[model samples]
Target: MFYEASDNDHKHGSFSEVRQDLVSGDWVVIATGRAKRPHDFLQEGKKAFRQPKRTCPFENLHENALLSLSLGAERGKNIKPWVKVVVNKFPAFQRGVCSIFHKTGPYQWTDGVGQHEVVITRDHERSLGQMADLEAELAVRAYQERYRAIKQDECVRYISIFHNHGRGSGATLSHPHSQIIGIPVIPSDIARSIRGSAVYYEEHKECVHCVMLKFEKNDKKRLIYENDHFLVFAPFASRLAFEIRIYPKNHVSHFEDASEAEIVSVANALRVSLGKIFKGLNNPDYNFFLHTSPIDKLNSFRHYHWHFEILPKTSIWAGFEIGTGIEISTITPENAAEFLRNIKV
Candidate 1:
């Protein structure tokens, strides 16, 4: 196994290092170079922020309570709508007559076989960074509940749940909301992840993610915050600097089956992580999304691990970035984490 210094890896302190990932065979530069001490990561005395309730669209969300959550209540609130799920006014994949597939030319496409829902909270402003733990938990529950329902569909092969915060983060409106797009075809990224894990599992008879978790746990430099069930950490080679990842300790394949308690734990970490970013960088925009096993072949994904990725909008990709998939991060993740770690929550 490729290894680095558990203690001497980050001499600049704040737990900085570049660790390699096993499954994708990609090296992640998980530098905590600029990271602040753990005690420095909390948000302190600041102006009590509010988005003027008069303009808040989510105040009376009952007007749009399309789906009931696992509990009696609806999903999301006005406080942390940034991370919650809301029904999309214009759904990309709307549900119609559920029919089978058909072949057209050499290409075969199914009857838009899935559901699309938006996870909206009761707020026009105040992102997950400013939300309460309960509010964030409520958002995660909505995702799980919706996933459970969507996966039951015979035609759905994959589901994507993602959040976009701030105008730069692709928020059409200043509202906080997440989107669930259930489609018949598994995403290319998901396929690659599954393929990588499958190949590794066949050769080693081990879950690569699990092995990474073990190493990360042992070396806590990259670890941000970990709860009873989940872990939040920065990757070694973050595509975008300060990229954060949340993973469940249990190697579960499907996010649809996540328990209520698990959701609470995840939402807590997710919110805190965002809050750290907000305070650290003075309200920077960010995007976060979930990656889980596909519903079509759920069992085959046992080798896979579900995780959430949070990418802050520190810089925009120009023409060169758009043309090529390769991203150039001006600020190293180690420095970004240093900036975030010092934030007071």
Candidate 2:
């Protein structure tokens, strides 16, 4: 059953209710018990963790590099690379026999036979938000290139490309880097998202994300930023405060399929979006990840529209959230979008 409140209750700012996600069909509570104004989130919670440059592993790239890009002049041998992709020093998954589930007394297991790599930008201190548009584009290009290479492995079924900004966001090192992990199995959350999208497509014959993007673009109330090829907006059912999503204007299932122009546009969109949060929210801890179709059966997920989701560390999940599997957001997306949209980043 739906948990909608009366219009008057919402108008009075006294409503605590649940909103269903159109794509994933998951519900998130807009709990007024812990309500917060958009600006109130700017108040510092925990200080961001920092690491010294001398001790940082990414400061000097001595590991066997998988892929490297140099934006500067290539004439000199000492010209440091702008962006580099290297295998994770301590990987959660490694090369092995293809994963196949084996029975184990009412339980099942498979080998963690996949690839994990780290994408490192040259600067230890410069984050994506602080990077120039071209610099950010090279990083995104690295993610796409590595994803293309990793997906070629027959054992890889899904690849996750994500960045963690602070200790709160699971970042152990202060160096600005993103991780790419290829897995033998599809994650439950991603599987649910794809299933929901497929269901919606079967019913409406259209991409669910494209439909949402169309409305968000037209509504403008939740639109934070938009370039020629991409749009950034707070989701109508944002699961957290200051949650932002960047979507391509056109429907594209695979991130690797994006054109060079589209890549540049997305990098600009990402930089601006993160810059706004960095300036407006006092550089809060956050995590951003790319959500795209799985590697196998690409044609089956043609209805999927790939995008990036940025979730700022706004509130902690307590019992109601963790136990119920429903996140509670203190601020509404409309207000979050309005606040971020006005920030001159």
Candidate 3:
């Protein structure tokens, strides 16, 4: 279950209170501490960083590709592939033993052992928001293929597939690219989400995300877009303004397990959703990432639901948010969803 404070829930003109996330159990403050209308978050006049093609590292064809996919007749050409996956030139984690914990003066530590690969789209200027449905599907397919390959590594405990859109969102290069990182340890945030799902399942005998999806689809207040196989919506307990999530209509535990049809549907949903944000909010910077079950114990997390979360850089964390470990969203999810729903993409 999720808890949110409606405008009427306020007493003595106080607008803010903490809302707990159903999956991660993290708290967020909604329209209380700081409040703004949805339009106020528009990123008009914000300049996006652009690197010249001559200087951009990803502008040329990539060699030593781990996986590559191409369209129709272009499959065998010497040109670049539609989508390509290559190891990161500078990886945060490297190929090494799954290090055991060692004591270091009362502290425990291990080597940062894992694999990191970059998934690059052929077009340097076209972001996912600007891509055609088929183009986006190819990118999603690349992620799935690379994920399947990386999960074969016994040392990998979790894999993260994420895209950073603009300078503010941490994209060093202007080229459109996503990253897949396989790590030996599960992220703390993901661990909490998994544990929460397990506890909820043990208590209710159903997936927490499935329950949320049912409610969101029926309520329709927080929903942005939906296709036959996927549903995109603004999360009720949004961590940031215009926070969006895309969930498969049917329960799925791992992203790698998604079928081709599901991938196509999700690709369309993602393209439309991101396009809406691009037009509605004046092309703001954003980051989107996949949240799925760990590779090591897939069956143990069947109660979990895999999904994609998109967080636009609408607000910066201040002292209160950083200190309390709770985010503050200036605009409510309902208003955010309503604004984006009417945007023509």
- Model 2, 63-111: lDDT tens digits are 9899998787545666554999999999999978896899999998999
Cα deviation at 85, candidate 3, in Å, is: 0.7
Candidate with top TM-score is 2
Local distance difference test values of all predictions, in order: 0.71, 0.89, 0.88
Error of 1 at 114 (Å): 1.7
TM-score per model over all chains: 0.79, 0.93, 0.92
- Tell me the tens digit of each residue's lDDT in model 3 across 28-129: 888654668778989988987688899977767556888888776445675544888889999998988778878999998778899999999988788999
| Candidate 3 lDDT for residue 337 | 93
lDDT of 1 by residue, 1-345 (tens): 655456446554445444445666554333355544433423344332345666666655544565644333435643222333455667777676666667888887667757788887654666777877877776788788788887777667889999887666777656677889988788887888889889989999998788778877777666777789998777655777668988989888778767777888898889889998887766667899998888755376888888899997765777866775545554455455555655668
lDDT score of residue 322 within candidate 2: 86
Q: Would you list the rank order by TM-score, best first? A: 2, 3, 1
lDDT of 3 at 64: 88
Could you give me the TM-score of model 2 versus the true structure? 0.93
Q: Considering only N, C-alpha and C atoms within 3 Å, which residue pairs clash in candidate 2?
A: none
